[model samples]
Target: MDLLVETFFNLAIMREALPLLLRGVLTTLALCAVVIPLGFAGGLVLAVLGTTRSRWKRFLLACWIDFFRAVPPLVLLIFVHSGLPFAGIELTAFAAVAVAFLLNNSAYYAEIVRAGIESIGRGQREAARSTGLTATQTLTWVVLPQAVRNVLPDLLSNTIEVVKLTSIASVVALPELLYAADMARSVTYNASPIVLAAGFYLLLLWPVVRLLSRLEHRIAG
Candidate 1:
């Protein structure tokens, strides 16, 4: 209790934890900021591929989706960052983590996008084709617009997942939130920094979460 009071109320505590914790928050946010957009891009690409008419291509995409979805993010990070040596392409921790996060998110968003695309009324596609639209044109101008609007809620939720998953990157010494907290504890023999770190994450995450929830309600309504 006293430790909490000292940690929360003391200027010394703030001085010590603030800088390190802020760095952690920033690093975590950076990781997510990069991964989320990349994930959306990858997901859209995969979704488009999956929607193509080629049977063999769809099979390959299913395998790609299953492989990433089956593998844990931490394990995938290791395999990509460190275990790819046998393939002669060793990736940096940042590269490996970003790739892993993006791929993981890709599987999820791809499925969501697939659902969104399918959820579009069949009549819309027929109407677009009747108006002299090619399949690609129909998809780009007609199907995608409604699909994106329909799936915005799912996309935002997935973005939150991408943000939270950055904690797993600590295992690779990515200098993200958990890594920063671990470093602080190691240096100061204090758990207070970690507590502060938790507060910071919640502080950062709360507004986004609330906004997402609000958006979900608005869309659902």
Candidate 2:
């Protein structure tokens, strides 16, 4: 146990690595804060537009969402960061990750939102119409509220997934937590930094997962 403590719990290593890891955490959080809402909003718009009466518009949006969804996130990240420059578009590593994350996340969120919207009964729409509500008002005031409640747990779970996915940004040297861990490990020639980073991930996500479970149970009840 002494050797283990010396490797992982050494105060000198901790003092040196912890601040870098914390900075990485801040970068990840900042990305998450932007990506989550922007992705959701983009998806919501897609879902709403998908419900339109125009068949051509619906088909186009469906194709766009499917293309993004079918592409792997890492591949998309590399394509945006590396390939875009060939096409006369330039982006920083951080911007590339943001673009890829937004696109990939929006596709997932669009499908989830679509499922939630479809889950609401047609009778609800009819009831709203009978009460002299416009199509817009009916959706805003009635159907959407129920659909959102039904899918709230799933959305939160997706949020957790997003948090974990942010680690992939390390591939581009964005200085996210995983990259910080990698750098620390390289400097110390020890695996402890990686383990510490894993612990940090668990610390960050475990509570959200538990909360998601509770919410699912509550909804089921």
Best by TM-score: 2
Worst-scoring 10-residue span by lDDT in model 1: 6-15
Q: What is the C-alpha lDDT of each candidate?
A: 0.85, 0.88
Best by lDDT: 2
Error of 2 at 66 (Å): 1.6
In every candidate, how many clashes are there?
A: 0, 0
Q: Which sections of candidate 2 miss by over 4 Å?
A: 1-11
| Cα lDDT tens digits for candidate 1, 1-221 | 88766654444654686787788888988888789889888999899888878899999999999898898988888888888878998888889999888889899889889889999999999999999999999999999889988998888887777788889899888998888877887787677777777777888789989998999899889
TM-score of each: 0.92, 0.92
- Compared to the true structure, candidate 1 yields what TM-score? 0.92
**How does candidate 2 fare on TM-score?**
0.92
The alpha-carbon lDDT assigned to residue 72 of candidate 1 equals 91
